[model samples]
Target: MKRVVFAVPGSLDTPTGGYAYDRRIVAELRQLGWDVECLNVGEGFPSPDKATQSAARSLLLKVPDGQPIVVDGLALGVLPDVAGEVASRHPLLGLVHHPLALEWGLSAERADALHRSEQAALALAREVVVTSPATAKLVASDYGVPAERITVARPGSDPAPRSSGSRNEVPHLLSVGAVVPRKGFEVLVAALATLVELPWRLTIVGDLTRDPNEAARLQASISQHKLTGRIAALGAVPSKRLAGLYDEADLFVLASHFEGYGMAYAEALSHGLPVIGTTAGAIPDTVPQEAGLLVAPGDAGELAGALRRVIADAELRRRLSDAASAAARTLPTWQQSAAIFATALEKLA
Candidate 1:
């Protein structure tokens, strides 16, 4: 049987965009008749300590000789030494969601180290698969990977029932992402505070435990803005619950610092909810002007203005919502993505 090993970081069940993409791709690959073996190298990756690094190296080394091995970029980017050794012996492919060096809040030295390491590791890959065209371009320009060897299989979105906007006086806003600095939930809060006169409630759905300190800080910010009563920080919920939130939302917004592929924005469009986000990274590619409003990243005033325009103008919101639903129909499916990924893997042979 045709087979391949997919080595990923721990917490395969995590309710994050990258993890979700991994899970869906793996399932579709198996259904397509490829024996996909998932190898869970230890977690705490992209910043793993010595012990974790050792454990990950050992696990990766155990794969049979000459077998095709695909490593998640979260793990692959930090292990250049191991990648060089393995790629010499096996058909190694690196699956990158985004470059780790682009993450927010990294020290200059650390970012440079990560960039150098990732560039070296990706250099050894037979080819690289990225989640979006933006990332493919980054891998080529920033990571020194050849553009020809990169394949872009944008994350797929499942069709969803159109959102039934809150049939009430107050509109409900939803934002989904990990409660981390990079996700920029704090920026969203700050922007929302400026529009206190508008009757809108914001609900942020994400893994609060991923960064407890950030969660605490966000809570404090809410209290400081006296928006504790208007904003609800519902930590990560199951897929069903998230769909329910989507159905209840009038608009979707996330002021992320950057995104390789903004899966949440796509999901919102699938649910027929108009989007309001920053034009950071792949966001503009994921969300267009017809479906939503986009502003400069970290600009609280701009975000507030965009939100006000959407909230106060029901006709405009309705038009954007219809456009979102139309765009959703054109999104790639998991099946199509899997077919492209399978073809990319076939090239490794």
Candidate 2:
């Protein structure tokens, strides 16, 4: 049987878009009749300390020689040395969501350091798998990876019932993602603060505990803007509850600074919800122009204007909602993405 070891950085069940993509794709790979073994390579990725680095390095070296190993970029990008050793002994494939250096809020020195290491690690991999064509192009142009060696396997969207939408006079807005600095939750808060005059409410769904500092800052923003009553932050909701929230919402919004593929945007379209997002990372690709209004990242004025336009104009919201459902039909399935991953593995083998 075809076999490979899938080394992920954290628990498969982590409540985030990247982890969700990892979890779904791994399951789909198993269903495709491949002997795919999953390994939790620890959580200290992209910035592992000495102990974590040593432990992860030792664990990977124990894999049988010549075995195919696909390492998630979270861990792989920071472990250039370990990746080099593994690539020499086995088929190494790097699954990159995005380059580590482009993440928001990084100092110049740290970003450059990550850039050098990731470039080295990606070079050692026999093949690379990315979540979006945009990411593939970025890797090739910036990291010096050959475009031909990279495969774009975007996250799949399961068929979901069209949102029933809100029954209240006030429009409901939903923004789903982990509470990290990269998500631009504070920007969203600031935008919403200006829209207090509009009849709209926001419900944020994400893991607040992931970044305590960001979470605390977000709360401060909420209180400072007097949005404590207008916006509800529900931390890391269950799938069923999240689905229900989506079903109840009229519009979906997230002011992310950057995204590898913006899986949440795709999921929102699948629910037939109009989107309010910033033009960052792969979001413009994930969210079609017809499906929603997009603003410049970190521009609260533009974001507020976009939110106001959608919230006040019921006809505009209806038009975008219709377009969202059409976009959802174009999304790939998890099985299809796994087939792409399997094909990449086969070609390298």
Clash counts for the predictions, in order = 0, 1
Per-residue CA lDDT of candidate 1, range 150-197, in tens?
Answer: 999999989899999889989999999999888888888898889999
Ten-residue segment with the worst summed lDDT in candidate 2? 39-48
Model 1 stretches with alpha carbons more than 4 Å out: none
Top lDDT: which candidate number? 2
Compared with the true structure, all predictions reach lDDT values of 0.92, 0.93
Q: Report the lDDT tens digits of candidate 2 across residue range 1-349.
A: 8999999987999888888988888898889988889988888678888888888889899999999999999999999999999999999999999899988889999999999999999999999999998898899999999988999999999999999989878999999999998999999999989988889989999999988999899999999999899889889988999999999999999999998899999999999999999888888889999999989999999999999999999999999999999999999988899899889999778
Off by over 4 Å in 2: none
